[model samples]
Target chain A: MSGQLLVFVICGAFAVLGALGLLFFHKAVHAALSLALVMINLAAIYAALDAALLAMAQVIVYTGAILMLFLFVIMLVGIDRRESHRELIPGQGVVAILAGIGTLGLLVFAILGSFPAQAVGLEAANGGNVESLAALIFGSYVFAFEFISALMIIAPIGAMVLAQQARLTAKKTQRERAAARIEAYAQKGVHPGTLPNSGVTALQDSIAVPGLLPAGRISTSSVSQAMVDRDAVVNVHAVSLLTAQRFAELSGEVPPAIIKPEPVDLVDTKDERELLK
Target chain B: MNPEMVALLAAVLFVLGAVGVLIRRNALVIFMCVELMLNSANLLLVSFAYAHGSLDGQVAAFFVMVVAAAEVVVGLSIIVSVYRSRRTTSVDAPDLLKL
Candidate 1:
């Protein structure tokens, strides 16, 4: 075996070990670091083959961008410092172990199986590397590419909405909870420490959108407007206001602005959550 | 080693990468796994490009890396926001749809 073979063997070993480490490791940061090692090794493998394009890509995307994001998230969430993360999920630890074993088994089976035989047969069909793949990805897989774009657009919106569902509920409940907490404390006539919790931040964001929810909780702050795209702003804010108002109505406290006794054509399929007077 | 052996090793890395991303529990780890997987794919493409005496695979790899970089920027922010909201790095915890 030559130096090149030795390099390949070493890098390949790191990639496999890193992959195993990624699976078995409990600490997220450690796993992330292991993944980075695997990526670097893969790049080295690319370099050994004289594939400069792939080598650079391996560095920039895997090392520079993606792994960095994982670290950033870990940092932002304070995962390393929190005690809550230490608490094992109900059945997760056992299940994760089982799943890991199952996954390893499946991968081993799949790889050692007949796929390579079929892959070799298909090699003749490939027109070339970058050009052909690009044509196919951008052409035949255009829908998939667009789907990815759509995912990029919709994921944040979905995540924000989902994460804030409880916060949204708490806004109304907060009104009640605040009244109760305040009244309980107020009877003692000592003002309860009025410092709001994280719930307030959600409400503040929701409110910043103009007319965007059950009670128009969204404010038309320029900063918020600047954050979202112009095309989506109107639609997002519109839906938000409708939903917010509907939620407020469920709380039986209709804001007077929309409570006017006019049979306005507002109660349509569009406002699915609106309650009739 | 010959190019074929290097190609084989690169393929091995690619396969490991896929396994890492698909199986990991922690979001950070999962993201790392994704990186590993992408890099592995890059290696496979690069090795094939060289063995076939073509530059196209390398070029395609460059574009893939560019897009991957963009993905990381957005993906990280999303994960960060999720961590802030849920206070957990476990991907299982983000299943807000069930709730």
Candidate 2:
């Protein structure tokens, strides 16, 4: 067998195995990696066929950019969620198998019946694959080429519109969030504070035990001390409304002062209580 | 090696891809299988281009790759949007239009 045939057989085997791996892998990320392997193998096949530009494009566009996008989406959406094994449509699997067999048979019949024994080689072309492809695309298929460019421009815009959370929706969500916080505070027999200032200033006073002071007084000191006092306040009201508000805004959780009882000792506690404090 | 033999292999690869697409439940896997089918077609195109001693088939294969790239962009965006809203990427999950 010729070297070209050997390369084709090896790459073809890899491509088939990669496709099977992609189909059977349980994890989406694994399946995506498998698809990448298949894409790379297909690029090799393209190179063996002497379509060098296509091989490079296959590697760069499909393997590099497109597969990266697939992996990104898989990760962003959380990859651990395995697809349910149960078929959504009853009898779909059997139907698909039959259809696949039918399609394959038809394709084979057509290939055997109509395909010429000898394919015309690329020797007639004046230049390399890239040069000839560029000439054809720019010369004969220029309109279709320009149309593809327009389609490419529109795709990103469409994706952005589809993925974007609308401003009105976000505002409504924020309002619902504020309402939930207020309801939570009401359930705990506490009044919710107003929104806090965005900027946090350092405390000037060097109080030995900042937690001893009421939450309202702590906000005037350093931001760190305010944070400490905010954590230590027994009475939800003792915590500065601002500090509590800021914490709620940042974490979407009520400050410890709002959730827990007051600690009798401020320091030197070894229990989980110190950690909580 | 004969061009007909290479064409036969491409056909097999395409059929395998089709079967995988039919059998796999994961939307992403189905997408990849579709890509496999496209690659097989590209291989056939290039093989024909080589056998026919013409540049047209290769040019056609190049166009197919461009179209496939565009398709990936749109298809992945749709998949991501679907996953975001429903938290699942199963091709069977999104059936709002089913009667």
Candidate 3:
């Protein structure tokens, strides 16, 4: 029954009660304000515990960055307030009630288990200062510290991408993707020079189509079949014209001509022998 | 546990605040819960200060107040801005929440 123990009991009660009130409250602003109360009280609690540096950080970092971020977001989103606009998830109330009860149980168990044990004063030992904690955090938790930096980078970028301003670029990207698909197909040598209204060419392709022809299109199908039958006449004409032009260029003999593409050697990074093994 | 009471209590308050944030749909409420958790730990530190009979705790607590005041100023302004963007004040309706 020490004076400090008594102080802890009183402050702890206030904190627990404040937290519960914050949870049960309906209005968000009120909750935030109450949470502020919790912050101040916590600082006081830390001061009582002889850890001055930690107390300040609690107020500065926790009260500063985290809460401000919350408020900023709250103001930005502008949710509908009318009861009609409330989109309550199914079983939410049930879950909330269960959570509240479970929280109460845990607090009670902790208090009971902790009862009668005299909470001693650790004034003799150093309550790891900023320097010591920073040493450990930077040394042992270097990865985690770096990870937080990465998170900071990623979170804002992610937020910006979803924002309304970015919607313009998003639409542009979609258009680019569609155009890319069309370009990719065209690059694969699919009738790049053909006119848009090349009905005869399309009809010719239909004859080679492997699937069923549509019903009531017997006339078109017959026309395509006739074109296929006239294939020898078309081929002979085209081949004769090409050969005549070549013969003229060669002055009748058409001396042997050859065109070759140079071979290219590319550097490979993989270990070929290891891969073979 | 006694020497670590502030740490333990700070941890508790912080956790409770987190729970408040998770359970409550109201943005303001969650924010307040977070502030509460911060202060709860602050109180533990103050108690430690008194226990150690040192003025460092007092100095830290003073700085914490300054930070808290600054936080309120900045936080409230941000909230005002957010309110303008979004008409409602519920956490569930945050624009970034949709999966």
Q: Supply DockQ values for each candidate.
A: 0.21, 0.50, 0.14
Give per-residue CA lDDT, model 1, range A1-277, as digits (tens). 8666788888888878887787777767777788788888878877666554456667876777677767767766654432223423476555655665665466455544332321222134345434555775576667766766776677556645544444422345667877887897868875466532211222344422334234433323322422342222333334435765776778888655543222233334433222211
Residues A89-187 of candidate 2: C-alpha lDDT, one tens digit per residue: 788878987887798788888777465665555656737777888889899888888887887788777777767744333445778878888897989
For model 2 chain A, the run of ten residues with the poorest summed lDDT: A196-205
- How do the residues B12-35 of candidate 1 rate in per-residue lDDT, one tens digit apiece? 555555555555556666666676
Summed backbone clashes in each candidate are 21, 13, 47
- Report the lDDT tens digits of candidate 2 across residue range B10-97: 8877887888887888887788889888988998998887777777787788778777877887788788878777768888888899
**lDDT (tens digit, per residue) of candidate 3 on A1-277:** 8675676678767766667667665655455556556655665566456555666766676666666666555445532232222536777656756675577466545644442244444444455556544554566666755665565566555444444232222445767866776786788844333223212221233432222123211122223333443331122222334555666687866544421111111112232111111
Ranking by TM-score: 2, 1, 3
Query: Against the unseen true structure, what C-alpha lDDT does each candidate score?
Result: 0.58, 0.72, 0.51
Relative to the unseen true structure, what is the C-alpha lDDT of residue A224 in candidate 2, on a scale of 0 to 100? 42
lDDT, residue A140, model 2: 88
Specify the CAPRI tier of model 1. incorrect
Number of the candidate with higher TM-score, 1 or 3? 1
